[model samples]
Target: MTTPPLSLRARRAIVMTAAVLCPLVAGAQTIAKPAIGPERPFTAPARVERTLSNGLRVVAVRYPTVPKVSVVVTMQSGLAVDPVEKAGLAQFVADAVQEGTASRDSRVIRREIFAMGASLTAFAGQDTSSFTMRGLADTLPAMMSLVADVVRNPTFPQQEVDLLKANTAQALQAQLASPQFVANRVYRQTLFGPHPYGRVGAAPETVANIDRASIVEYHKTYYRPNNAFVVVTGDVTPDAAFAAAEKAFGTWARGTVPPPPTAALPALTGRKLVFVQRPNSVQSSISVGNFTIRRSDPRWAVMNVANQIYGGAFDSRLVRNIREDKGYTYSPQSTFQAMGQAGLYRAVADVRNDVTGATLKEIYGEIDRFREGGPAEAELVNAKTYARGLFVIQNATQNGLSATLNTIYSFGLPNDYPETFQKNVSSLSAEAVKTAAQMLLGSQDSVIVVVGDYTKVKDQLVGFTNITFVDISGKPITPPQ
Candidate 1:
């Protein structure tokens, strides 16, 4: 009749968390020896950078740990550039780049990457468009050249564009029906409003509207060395990486300046709720919260501290209350996503459809409480220590460090960001955190979007809304008109 005891993993996690939080031996407050300390001392590998005649910045690092090379070609253009009529063109274009190139077809390119034990990739995202490759270092020259070709000469074959359109339409059909996908789709809608960021990646009807002509325009406008960068990291020296890159991308043409992001997003304020009704489902996925500060804000350290304590990690309040106390969900977490231009803050969780209302109620109660009360002293200290400690691994891993470096440089932050993080986080005061929480946490500006079984949870959902029922394609389904 009684519930069983907590599992060993959960019990050990609690104890380890406690030790990590307070390893001091009394008066001095010195940190204890690291529990799983690294086998060797940490040292930053040197990196080198260059600017091409055409204005592309190149950054390279030689890793030597594994021969696998990672070449990333990046552009400043991102989803912020999506023309209103073509919401997902950048993504499709990124995909098409590898589908075929000036010298070889998509099939040939795909075969080359696989034959050489490499992966070819491209990502057109919200703020940046990029092409990447991972392969043995000896094959890097060939891979880099292939990447340059894709960037320079994406033929955008008519048939391929049609294929992408059809594939994406099918994928969108499946994704729209997924609970978490639905939660994200509508959550963005409610949070960002008319902003391109708010647009669903694809609506069933909208996918068909995409065509090759629009794809070509988006590509020509965005992909050029003048607007991009080349970043290489992994098992080769900077000199080697540089030479390999130059031989590939050196002569790529410069491009005209991109027009500013299609439009700026407006601020979100006040409480809002969105509900999607799935006729039969066992559970619901929910997302709540709204935008926070940009990545480069002076308030980052304090905001980071506040978020870590609130829901940035498992030991965070959202987890403690929403799962451990209420037993409504498996887990709850929050993310403070700050990038070069802007940022967003949101918390998410999933619970049985039957408990959707109760789970949401508890989540809000915790968010508002933390905003008012601030994190406990123990919570604050643990979060600070955790934030500072993460830097070791952040710098230790080749890919991790490279990504960190790219973000730091891309955002125009000072070179010492990795070093500054720990000291800054540790120095934050409780009051500073409270101020940040007030700024970053829930305002009535809070928005909640839930996707779950309609028949099971609608009555409960009505308690919060002037309810709106939208279907899987993100379309409004009118009852048998």
Candidate 2:
């Protein structure tokens, strides 16, 4: 028989007594932290490489876990190849490539892509621009053909070019209202000077200057088979993928690509500070940056680990100091990017106008602290684990694998980069990380950009003597007296 229900007073007494005893019982038991297991070995999927008679390179990797595939055709010419007078020409050409092809208009291209259950897109970066497509496994050949048509046969229709320019001009106006955009533009300009890396985007005036003739000329000069490669990943056989690439791109004529730009990066002697005055603003967007190394540098792994321990990780010293401890900002982050010719390290935070100086102080303090003594053994181990885990997760999908292959070939990395990446990250020593920090982590010789109401933050920024004042357009102006 079931026990009879207790009276209300009796039930309350029993619950209170059980709650009091549970803590005592829990305190008496000691639980050890579970040991972390050795990481399972990762075998990179086998990749097959082929070259077409016209000098187009194709890399195909077999990833049969899904029923789809991703393909990216990347040209080595990008923003760096943009003529100095035409800042956004490469990106303009990239965007226009998908607008219309010789055989099909944008509308027809979109319809065909939709019917195949596919997406087609393109973008330009500092060192490379790529046209990418993803579709069903059975549609691999069709996807390749479409991407080839888009890249090789862009018409750069005059009407489309004019509309794109108008749209871009409008977009630039909207972006300028953002303080972070202004801060970044000024910061990069300060760091890179006349280097192509500094020119992140075109101004409204610059966009107005982009015409169909320039777009066509830019594409003809750079979009050559000899200067590009295709990466395919998914549930497709290597032979089938290679044949699709060759069949699609074999007839495309190779062109002589101009030598890459060789502009010198500006030297950073002392702290270069700039302030963009956004009147009546309540917050400041700050960017602290310094030039570092190239993507293929042997020291890249060491620098990456150092960055993670210092600020790259969400739980890093910078985040802990500025966000968790001082509560100055939300989502403060630092990033290390390695480009084809150079690299950059940047830490950014948007803080309340009053606490901007305090946040900067803490950022510099954390950098100095990390550079002097390096990460502790435990911190180093944790960072390495995170890095290795991140690498695996990032490349565990078809899209990610294709992008990885794009980066490998774009930066001239060895074919076995995927195989060696985890091992390199795991092997970094604490001393090596500290050495990297000392070599690159900057406090004195850095570019600092702050965008806010100049009057509100000017007093806090009094310590900076080499500061330059600019308006939202990055045009220099006299600071308010």
Candidate 3:
């Protein structure tokens, strides 16, 4: 078949048509997105607080949006107070508390709670242990009773303790297989030295040594009405909530809670490197950080803002540089943990073994840049907006409100801390963030931890002055014969 070329007139018509359609397609692709509306003023619900005759504090907030209630009973006892020998006693007690009470076994407790379409959970952190429950408002009384029984009368059955120990031992063994876990464990120990905060998780041997008697004693010493508080949020009025609290916990006799344990932390002199050799690891998990200020520091707000701009979000400098620009890893994050004592500032990532050294260099560079100049005005504004948005999202529901209140009491913060946070973060300036960075992010003192094939990556870490090898438990390791 033979085809003839198009005439000049026809070609001109086709070109004009194509040009017109292309602009329409481009316009469709570039359609404007809806603008975000102005943030609504967030006024936290007024919380009513009362102290029972037995010294139990009850804090309640009314959220009558639905016929539901959220309850949390928090004890001031946590890992910080654990005896040196019994490193995991508090955690074991937290797990075994609900396994059986004087009147109900685990099965019966689970069934009863589920029968009411309710949920209950208990957990232990560095500073506090808490038991939480959520259910229909009508079941508030029953829920409170169940919570009190578990908190006051846990039997800590020998069989359950054995099972928990075995399960925890297994979990610990599994975690040791993960490079990220190894890096974090060693990083904490290196940063905090022998302080309680250094002991982030229980050793398998420590778990094995925990017994029923020690668990009972630990509970007796710490879980007292005088040492605990309750937060109730949902459909009930403050008076009704207080009455329920007294009915459930008024008879719980008060006991003395031991003062927080203290230990002198070993000084971190200069940059150090700790490596855990994972045989044939394809990726290296790296953590770099040092201790900073306590939760009560005046610069806490500035640190929060600076952290967001550094590596706290997807668009943060670390993430943007290493992941998006350099293609090192998928997600890299920086976190700040401000506790009663000196807090922790950590930046972490898992990168290919080949790029291990490069990743470390980039992390240090970003941190140095932040400390030197802080964030620009536009960046500061964006970070503050992000922080304020998170505040609103954190208290959007009854459960969320209850959790926030628990955090306030656990941290020894004032009742108006949320309001204070909103005001402070909103007013943060670029200069404030810069000052905070200079004070807190001292790169010279950071302890860098890397878990990878040491044989391949050790020489790559050339800039570090002091490099030590450690096992998964953070104990020093000897070179292979």
Provide the global lDDT of candidate 3 against the true structure: 0.86
TM-score of each: 0.86, 0.93, 0.93
Q: Which stretches of candidate 1 lie over 4 Å from their true place?
A: 1-43, 262-264, 458-467, 477-481
Per-residue CA lDDT of model 3 for 153-222, tens digit only, reads 9998889988998999999999999888788888887888779987775787688677888999999999
Against the unseen true structure, what C-alpha lDDT does each candidate score?
Answer: 0.77, 0.88, 0.86
Better of 1 and 2 by lDDT: 2
Full candidate order by TM-score, most accurate first = 3, 2, 1
RMSD to the true structure for each prediction, in A, is 8.1, 4.9, 5.6
Q: lDDT order of candidates, best first?
A: 2, 3, 1
Question: Candidate 1: which pairs clash?
Answer: 62-236, 63-234, 64-235, 78-127, 78-128, 79-126, 99-106, 270-444, 270-445, 271-444
Q: Per-residue CA lDDT of candidate 2, range 20-87, in tens?
A: 99998898787667898777656789998988888999999999879999999999988887776788
- Identify the runs in model 3 with alpha carbons over 4 angstroms from their true place: 1-28
Candidate 2, poorest ten consecutive residues by summed lDDT: 201-210
